[model samples]
Target: MSSLLLRHHRPFLAFWFARVFTASGFQMITVAIGWQMYALTGNVLDLGLVGLIEFMPKILFILITGHVADRFDRRKVAALCQGAQGLIALGLLLGSGAGGISREMIFVIAFLLGTARAFEMPTTQALLPNIVPSNLFPAAVAASASAMQAATIVAPALGGLLYALGTHWVYGPAVVLYSCALSLMLSLPARQLPLKQKVSLESLLAGFRFIRSRPAVFGAISMDMCAVLLSGATALLPVFAKDILLTGPWGLGLLRSAPAVGALLMSLWLTRFPIERRVGPVLFTSVAIFGVATIGFGLSTSLWFSLAALVLLGAADMISMVIRSAFVQLQTPDEMRGRVGAVNGLFIGASNQLGDFRAGVSAAWFGTVPAVMIGGVGALVVTGLWIRLFPELAKRDHMHPQPNPQPPSAAA
Candidate 1:
């Protein structure tokens, strides 16, 4: 299994390590931002705004970023983005050290960081296919997902501990990690595709057109987007940690890490026993399970119970994430990968950041518990609706790219 996953793939391994370091640092920064923002404002809505601030750049420049990723060297783009993120971390560190860091300053830093991410996400995603053999793509995806989950598992706990010391402590190490990721990215073999002769509005929008013409890709991305948008409980974790469960920063770390722990375990399992059939049903079932787990998490006041629910949620989400990633990467043509990835990133950014914003506003309108519970119910409703609306997705039996059963006209 190990050989199948990582044998003779040094560049891929480097990419994986880069992911680990980058993800860990980013996760640490995330924890510090959340805790410090909540500390400063004592407002749950501010926590949600953190995501919103980060998301705005992606909304603004994702298309251009994706086009750049396709037109230039993806590795260099990623390296440049990593360097930008490292600078942002340094900025955060300096601001924290200078004392009296304002909420607005934090928001500004978040926007800059999000800007770096907007470029980094599509470039990094598009680089994956270029790094490894086509036949080993699934294994590579599984391994990459596992590495990310592992980072998520460790980073939050580490960040929480570092945050307990000082917010600057979190930023300082994050700077180092981001620098390391930049170095690794710089070292990767360059694979720049030839640029198109002419740029047009149609070329820029081709990814959208492709997805619209392929129901499976459309269904998968839309389902994950809606489910996650409704069910996401991550943004409200600090509220639960401080007010509901009364766990404190340390407890918040554990709460944040719980889902990743489950995800890591599931990713490891998938690496060993790759899902070969009925992938659509697996995706739907996992999402439904994720919704149920979110409901349980929303209702739980106890730390242990909440952790269990989050773990289940993570496990289920892992399945959907792996399947969806494979679908997007495998199904799309290489020339269009970056643009498609950008669109996918947009969906992800909207779901995660906007979901946090939604949670925050809802928590402000209703109580925290009610907001989370309602979101969970909304996820369940989305799952049912998606299944009914996109029955072909449920019938999708394999992960490998296949001929579309529906004609383009029917898909539209």
Candidate 2:
């Protein structure tokens, strides 16, 4: 296995490590931002705003970002995005060191960072299938996911620890990591650009049309968007850590890392033993478990209990993600990958950032615990409704369907 991976997957290995650096840096920056903002304002709504600001670019530029990835050099686009993020982190470092950082400044920087990510997410997603052979794509997804989850598991914890000294400590390291990621992005082999086509309104909306036409794909993607949109509670962790759990930055760090720990382990498992049957059932069931875990986390007062619940939540969500990612990529043709990935990225951004907004606003209105508990319940409700609304999702028997056999043409 080692020999095969080394010989056939060297580019994947480079991509793998690149993800580690990039995701790790991004996660650390996120932790510092959440902690610093909450400390400065003592307001939960501010946290939600950060997510909304970051997510706004996705909505505003979804059409254009997708087109850029589809038309331009994907590696160059990814490298540019990473460089922008590095600059943003460096700015934060300088501001924090000078004791000049404020809530407004954070929000502004978040918007800039979001714009970079809006382009980065789809371009990077579209890059993978091009590098790895189709037969090996599922394994590559699992391997790549494991790398990402591993970075996620450690970075927030490290960020939390570094925050004890100063925000600059966190931001400083994040800038360096982003630089490393940028270098790696440049190292990746270039993908063949999609064939030239007419630029029009129809092209911009193509991704939306493609997703809607496929029932199972639509079901899987929409289910993720709705379920996570409700179940997300990470935005409120600072509140929980300070008020309910009565722990400092270290405990908050552990709380943040718990989910990624679960996710990393699950990714590793998937790499060795890919899902073979009942793909739809597995996807729905895992999401249901995710909801259950979220409720558990919200209701727990003990830090250990909360961490455990989060771990379970992460594991369940990871299972659903691997299935959705592999299925979507396999079904998409190379020419359409960037656009499709863009729409997928939008759903992901909505489920995550908008979900944060939901959690934040709800926490402000209903109090933290009740808001989270209600969201978890809402996730369960959404899952049930999705099963009914998209029965084709429930009927799916494999991780991905076998390609339809094409008939012989006159040329053949």
lDDT, candidate 1, 292-311, per-residue tens: 99999999989999999999
For model 2 the local lDDT of residue 127 reads 91
TM-score of 1: 0.95
| Colliding residue pairs in candidate 2 | none
Off by over 4 Å in 1: 4-7, 401-412
Worst 10 residues of 2 by lDDT: 1-10
For each candidate, C-alpha RMSD in Å?
Answer: 4.3, 3.2
Candidate 2: misplaced stretches above 4 Å?
1-3, 402-412
Error of 2 at 62 (Å): 0.6
Question: What lDDT would candidate 1 get against the real structure?
Answer: 0.88
lDDT of 2 at 103: 98
TM, every model: 0.95, 0.96
Error of 2 at 122 (Å): 0.4
Q: Write the per-residue lDDT of candidate 2 for residues 179-250, one digit (tens) a residue.
A: 888888888787565648777999888999999998888888889999999989989999999999999887
